[model samples]
Target: MEPLVVAMLLLLLARGHSALGLGGRNMWLIKEKVLQAREQRARDHVRGGQRWSSAALGSAQHLEPQEEFFPQPLDHFNRQNNATYKQRYWVNTKLWEPQGGPVFLYIGGEGALTTYSVLAGEHVDLARKYRALLVAVEHRYYGASINPDGLNHRNLHFLSSQQALADLAMMHAFISHRYNLSKLNKWICFGGSYPGSLSAWFRLKFPHLVHAAVASSAPVRAQLDFTAYNKVVSRSLSNPVVGGSPECRATVGAAFGAVDEMLARGESAALERDFRSCRPLDGSGDYGQLAGNLADVVMGIVQYNHELGIDATIAHLCRLMANTRLGAPYRRLVALNANYMERMSLNCTDNSYQRALEELRSEVVKPYGVGERQWYYQTCAEFGYYQTCEDEGCPLSRWLTLRSEVDVCAQVFGISASSVQGAVDFTNDYYGADRPKASRIIFVNGDIDPWHALSVLRNQSRSELALVINGTAHCANMNPPETGDPLSLQHARQIIEEQIGDWLSRRPLYPL
Candidate 1:
C-alpha cells in the first residue's frame, strides 16, 4: 500500500477532539451550542412577530431498542489473565434478507454509543440498499460498555485501539453464532470521524473478518502539534467555497492580535471587565485557556456550520464582526462571545473569558464526564494529536501555544512531555506510522474539515480508494443526503455504494 494509505488506516482508529462529528468526545458541546442557538432564534422570532411555541430544543428522539451485551476479555493478548467485561452492542436487522446478507458494522468512538444517531439514518439507508444487517458496537469503556474496574489510569491500559479491534472481532463471532448466521460471510464496516478510523483499521487488521470498509473523515496520521487543524479552520473561514467574507476574516484576525497585545500589556482587569469573565486572569495559563476556548468556539462553528443554519455561517460571523455599529474590536469581541454564550446556553454570570478558563480546567480533570477523560487518556497513551496553535501564521496563535498544551497534558494525565513523546513514538511504530498495509477500504473526507489534511487523499491500491468531497463540512458524506448537498458529496456517496456492492459480490476464499 501507498504510505498515505497505510498511514490513513493506522490513523483512522484514533479520535481527535479538534474535529466535529459523532466520533469525538466534544460532540456534546457542539450539539448543545447549535441546539441552543436555534432555540434562541426561534424565541426571538416569536417575540418580534407572533405568539408561538417552538418544539423543545435538543430534545432526544425516541429510538427503538436493539441493544445487547457480550462478555469481552479484559486482555485479548493475555489468555492467562482470563478477566472479562461486558461490551455493549446494538443490532438492527430489520432490513436484512432472510437467507443470507452482508453485515454492516458501525463502530463507536470516544463518546457514549447511545448518543450516536448518525447510524440510524444514512447507514440504515445503506443497509436497506444492500439488504444487510446493521450492527452498532459501543467502544469499550464508553457508554455502558464499562470495564469491571473503575476508569482510572490503571483500567485504561486495556482501552487501546488494538484491544478495541479485538473486541469487534469477538463480537462478530458471537453475533454470528447467536443469530445462526455463520453462512453470511460478507461483512462491511462503516464509521465516521474516529470511528471512521476504526472502521478502516478493522479491515486493515482483520481483512478476513471485514470484506470492505467505509471510513469517513478518518485522519490516519498522528502528530504532536496539530497546527494544521487551526490552519484549516482559518482557510475555511476565508475560502469562497464556504462563502467566507474577506472583511470578516480581517476583523477576526485583528481581534485575535489585539487581544494578544492587551494581555501582553497586563490588561487582565480590562479584559475581565470587557469579556465578562467570571474570574480575574491570574496568569498566562488562564489567558491561554481563554484563548483556546475562543478558538474552539470558532472551530466548532465552522465544523458544524451546515447544521447551525445560515446565522451561524462564516459569512454571518464576519457580518457581526465587521458591523460598524459594534464599535471597537473589544465590543466586537464581546458580541462574538455573547453570540457563542447564547448558542451554547451558557447562562453563567461569569463572562466568556471566565467560562473558557473553567472549561479548560474541567477538560483537564474531566470531572464533568467520562468521555473527556476517556478520550484524553487515549491521546496520552496512543496518539498525541494535540490541537495546538503551533502555526504562527494562524490567527489562533494569539492565544495558544505548544507549551500551554503540553502543560495541560502534564497536569491532566500526570505525564511529562517526554512521556507523551515516548507514547506517540510507540503508537506510530506499532501501527506502521506512514507505511500501513491495508486493503478494501474506502476513505472519505471533506476538503473543509481540519482532519482531512491528516488522511489519505490518494489511491494506494485497487481496493484502497480515497474520496475527497469539495464544498462540504466534516463527515458530510456519512450523514443522510440532503437536497442542498453539494454534487461532489452526492457523487461520493454513489461511488461508495458502488464500491461496497462490488466488494459484497466477490466470493471469499476462506470460509467462515
Candidate 2:
C-alpha cells in the first residue's frame, strides 16, 4: 500500500510541471503576435506617407510609402543626459540617396511645420530637379519636436541662437552620415525671418560646409529700435493711389499722437478714436481693421519710411471702417498689411516688448539707460501679448532693461560694436564673415513691406544677390506681380530653376 501511494504522488507532480511549461509557451506566442501586428500597422502608415514626402523619425522596421500625412509611426532611440533627461528627434529618412545631387537643407523660422511644409511644397519641383533632399526640421520646444519638461524659463535659457546653430550643424552631419551621402556636395542653407537669422549664423559658423546661403528679413542686430521703425510703416501708407489722401494722412497722424499722449498719461480715453473708428475684421472676433492699420504704422517706423507706412496704415483703416462688409479688396489689403505686421509685432513683443516693460519699471525707480527715455516708461502695467492697446505702444520700450552682453560687432557681425552700432552691426555680420561662395542666392521682397530694411542688409551682403520682384507684400515669389510691373518675376522663376539645375548637375568647387 505505501509503494502504490508514492507512485500516485510522483505521477501527479510530473503532470503539473508539464501543464505549467505549456502555459508559459502560449504566453510567449501571444506577445510575439501582438508585436508583429504593431509593426505591420506602422509599415502601412509609412507607405501612405510616400504620397507626400515626410520628415523622418527613426524606426526599427522598414517604412513603406502611402498618400497620407504621418502614415506610419517611427520609433525613437532615447538617449538620456546625466540628469536622466532625454531629448527627442526624428532621424529616419525615406528618400535619401548616397550620391544624389546637392542637398538643400531648408531650416524653418519661428512658426510650426504647417508653414514650413507649405513653403517647401511650393518649391518641390525645383528641389526634385536638383536631386536635392529638402529637410524641414522643427526647432526645440516648437511643433512635434518637443523636449518634455523643457519649455520653462530655466530650461529655455539653453534655447539661444548659439544652441540653435549647433542643432543645425549636428543635424546636417547626422543626416549625411546616416544616409551614406557625400558631405562634399553643395550644401545650401536658406530661410526667412527668424530662421533667416539661423541661416546667417550657419553660414558664418560652417563656411566650408555651406556653399551658399539666403537669409531674408533676418534681424541680427540684438539691439533694434522699434519706435524708430514707425517711419517705414508711415511711408507705406502714403502711396498716392491708395493711402495718399490728405484727410487719411491727418487722421492717422492724429490717432498715433493721441496714443502717444495716452501712454504718457495712462488714460483709457486715449484709445477713444481707435476704438470708435475700428470694428472687428470680418471673421476676426474682436480685432478690427484699425489693428491692421496699426500694424502698418509699426512696420513703416522700422524701415525709416514712417510717412508712407502711417499714410497707408490709416487709409486702410478708413477703407475698412467705411466697409463693414469685409469684401475681397479689403481682405486682400488687410492680409498683405497684416502679414508683414504679424512678424514685426511678434519680434517686438517677444524680444523688445518685455525689455520695454522692464524699462518702464526702472525709469520711475532709477535713471534711464541707452534707449529712448520717453518711450521707455509706460503708465499702463497690464498689457499682454496678442492684446493690442488703443493707446500708444512702446515697441522698443520693453527692451530697455536687459542689455545684450554679447559682443554684437566682434562675435556676431565680424566688427566691433564697441565702436559702431545699430543696423551696421547686422549688415557687417551678414556680408563680412558669412559671405556665400555660390552665385545662386535669391532675395525676394515686396516694395511696400515694412521689413524692407532687409533690402539694406541684402545690399550690404557680398555680390551675386538677386532681387526677384518688387512686391508691395511679403514673400511674393509664389504670388507674382501684376502684368505691367518692371520686375521680370516670371524671368526670375526661370533663372532660379536654371541656376538650381546647373548647380545640381555640376556641384560648385566651393571652399571647404
Candidate 3:
C-alpha cells in the first residue's frame, strides 16, 4: 500500500524506515503513503548525500524539474537569528506563456521532493494548458532542507506549519520577482495530504499572493485523538465501490481481535515469530508497538486503497483476511503481514519501543529523522494528528490508545500529554478548521481516504468549493490521468480544470 498511500510520506523513509511523514502519514504519517522501494530510494539518495541535479531526479528528457535552491532565513519570525539555509525548489518554464500566465506552485509535503511532483500530474497538465510556470518548494525541515544547527527538540522548535507558511510567503516574493509576476499573473498553489493543507492555508493566510488553491486529500483540521481515522479505515474495508465488503471488514476486525486474545494467552513468542517482530516482546510498550505496526498495514491500504491498483491493495488484503482456506483469523493476519512485509521489502517489523525512544531522544538528525522525529515534533507542538485506535469499530488492537501515542511527546519533547489538545485547538483556530473563509480554494477529498474525514467534504460557499469524489483514494485526482481511472475521479479533475480557468478569467471574486 506504500504505492497506494504514495502519500509517498511526504512517509519520508518509505524504502525502509517509517516516520510520521505526515508525522505518521508524512511522517505519509497522516495521508496516503507511497510504497515502491525504487521510488523511495530515489528520494533518499537526493536527500542524504547527492546534490539536486537532473540525474539525481530522473531524466530531464522526461520533463524533470531543474533543481534549484533559495537562501531562506533559518528563523523567519526572529530577526535576531540572521542565519540562513538553502531551501530546495524546482521550476520548469517549458510551458510558460510569459504573458498573463499563472504560476502553479506544487507545495512539497512532510517528506522529500521528487521529480514526479513537478514533471507529472494533473497540475502539470494544467500548467501545459494555461502555459503556467510549474514550481515545487520543499518543506524546510524535511528532505535535504535539514539545517546543520541540530535536530534537538529545542532546535526543532522552529519546524512547524507556521514557519513553513512563512517560507512559502518568502518564496512567493522571490519567484514573483524573478519571473516578473503580478496580480495578472495569478498564482495557484497545489498540494496533497499535509502539503494539501498548506495549499489551502496559504490561500487563507496570504490571499494577496495566491489567487486559487487545489488542496487534495488535505486534512485541514488538527485532531489530538484521531479515532475517527480508524473508523473510516474500518468502513473503507467494506466499501464495495473499491471492492470491499462487510465480511471482509469483519474478518479484518476479527484478525486483530485474535491477536489480542493470543497475547492474553501468553503467546508472545509465537506472535513475534509469526509477525517477525524485530525484537522480542519485552513490555507493554513493545506489545503496543507490534499491534501498531500491524495496524499500519491496514491503514496504508485503506488510505490509498485503489491507488495504482498495484500489490497489497485493499481488495487483495480483504481476500487474504476472509479466505477460509488461510485457516483462522490469526493465521490470516499472519499471512497478510507476510505479504505486506515482503511487498514493502521489510526484513523484520521493527516493533522496538526502546529503539523508538532512542531515536526520538537522539539529538543527531540522521537520514530518516524527517519522516519520524521532525514530523512528530510538529505533531507534538502544533498539529496533534495522533492516529489512535480507540474508536468503536476500529479494526486495530485496543493497545494503540491515544495515551500510547502522546506518551512519546511527553517523553521526548517535554510536551505534556495533557497539552496536546491545546496544541490541536490552536491549529484549528488558526486555520479555521474545516470552515476557512478563503475563496477560490477547491478542497478535493476522496471518500475512501481517512484523511478526508478532517477535510472540507461539503461546499462552504460559491467560491470556496469542496469536491468529494466517491470511491477514490487519497489525492487520486492529483495523479496523472491513467487508463481505467474512476469516473468520479476523472470528473473531479475536469471540474478543477474548469474552476481554475474561471478563476483566471474573472477579476478577484473575493476582495484582494
Candidate 4:
C-alpha cells in the first residue's frame, strides 16, 4: 500500500498515538498478524487454482553455512591490552570469479548474524553481475561475537562504532589471507539501517579497505531528540499525492486533542479503562511509555513497508482499519491494535507497560542482545536517535516528553542524560553527521521513512550520492526485487548497480 494512505488510516485510528504498552503483547500481535495474512493469502491462491505452501513463502533467498569466526581485539584503541574475542562472519563464493572481482561485504548491526542470509536475493544478483564474493561480518559484541567476560556496563565500552569498524577492517584482512582472495582488490560495503551507517563510516575511515559503499536507509546524523521522526510520520500520513485523506488526518488530530484535554483534566483512570491498558495510568512517565509503545506499532509497519511481501503495508493496515467492528475512538484503537497483531503475527499475551519494561531489563544478557536494552545502550553511548515527541505537530500527546526516553537510558544502563548528550555530540563531531568526510557512498532512503530526516538526503561530494524513493519505506531497495515495486525503487536500484559497476571498473586513489 502507498505510505500516505497507510498514514491516513493510522492517523484516523490514532494507532500511531498510543494503545497497548506491553512489549510481549506487541510482539505477539505482530506475529499473529503475519500468520493470518499468510493464511489469507494462501486461501486466495487456492481460490485461483494455485498450490500454496510454506516453502513458497520461504523461497525468496537462502544463506550458506555460516560457521566462521575471526579473532578481534577487545579494545581497538588500546592495543597493549591484548584481550581478544571471536567475531562471527559468513562468506559465499558461489558467484565469485576469482579473477580480481569486487567483494560485497555486508556489515551486521545490533542483532544476531545468524539470522542474516549469506546472500539476499538482490545482493546475490549483484554478486553475479560483478562476479563478486558475498561476505557478512557480525559487529563486535553482537550475535555470537560476544565479549568473553559479559555485556556489563564495563564490557560494553568496546561496543562503539569505532571498534566495530576496526573489527571489519581486521576481518577484511583475515578473509583475504584465509581465502587467498588478495587478487580481489576492490571491496564494496553494503548494509541496511544502522549497519548502513557503519558501511558508509567504514568507507570514510578506512578508504584503503572499502572502495565504495551502499548505505540503504542509513541515518548518519546523531540527534539526542529526534523529533523530526514523528513530523515525517505526520507528513507521510497526510500527503495528498499519496492519497492520504484530509478527513482522516483531521479526525486523528481531533482525537489526539481530546486525549490531551482528558489528560489535563486528570482522566487517567478513564483512559486506562477505555484503552484497556494492563496497568493504571498514574503519571506522565506511564503516559509517555504508553505513547512510545503505540508509536512503535505505526513506525514499525511503516518502516518495513514492502510491495510484494507479506510484511504489513499501509494498504493492508488501512483496509483493516476501515473494516474494524469496534466503535468509539478508544475501542477503535484497540481494534486497530488487534489488526496489527493479526497482520504482524506478534504473539504477545500481556500488554502492560510494567511487563514490557521488565522484559527489557531481563533480556539484556541474551545472545545478540535482541532486547531493547542493547540498542538503547548504543543510543545512549554512541548515536542518540531517541524518538521523542518534543516538537510541534507531533501526533502523540505533549505529555510524552523527551525526558522520559532519556530516563529509560539511565534506568536501563545507569547512564546519565548529560553523558548521553555528550556521546551524541561526540558522535556528530567524530562522524561529521550528514556531511561526513566520505566519498563513493550511495545513501538511499525512502521518502516515507521516519528516519529519513536524520539521513543524508543530498550529495555532499561528487561521488557521494543521496537517492530518495517516493511512496516507499525503509530499506525498500535492499529487499528482493518485486514485480510490483515502485518506479522510484527500481530507479534507485539501477543507480546503485551502476555506481557499484563504475567503482569496480576504476582503480583506488589512495592518500585522499
Candidate No. with top TM-score: 3
Please give, for residues 191-213, the per-residue lDDT of candidate 3 as tens digits: 99899999999999999889899
Give the best candidate by lDDT: 3
Q: What C-alpha RMSD separates each model from the true structure?
A: 9.5, 24.3, 8.0, 7.5
**Whose TM-score is higher: candidate 2's or candidate 4's?**
4
Q: What's the TM-score of every candidate structure? A: 0.83, 0.53, 0.88, 0.83
Task: Give one digit per residue, the lDDT tens place, for model 4 in 99-197.
Answer: 787788988886665523454545655886887878988877766788645466667677789988889888988888876776455888888789999
- Candidate 3 least-lDDT 10 residues: 18-27
lDDT values, one for every candidate: 0.67, 0.38, 0.77, 0.67
* 201 Cα displacement, candidate 4 (Å): 0.2
- lDDT of candidate 2 over 435-487, digit per residue (tens): 33334455545455544443333544343454534434433343212344335
- Ranking according to TM-score, highest score first: 3, 1, 4, 2
Per-residue CA lDDT of candidate 1, range 254-335, in tens? 7776766665566778777665666776555455545655666667767776767666666677778778798976578678
- Report the Cα lDDT for residue 163, model 4: 87
Poorly placed runs, candidate 3 (over 4 Å): 1-63, 366-370, 508-512
Among all windows of ten consecutive residues in candidate 1, which has the lowest summed lDDT?
A: 17-26
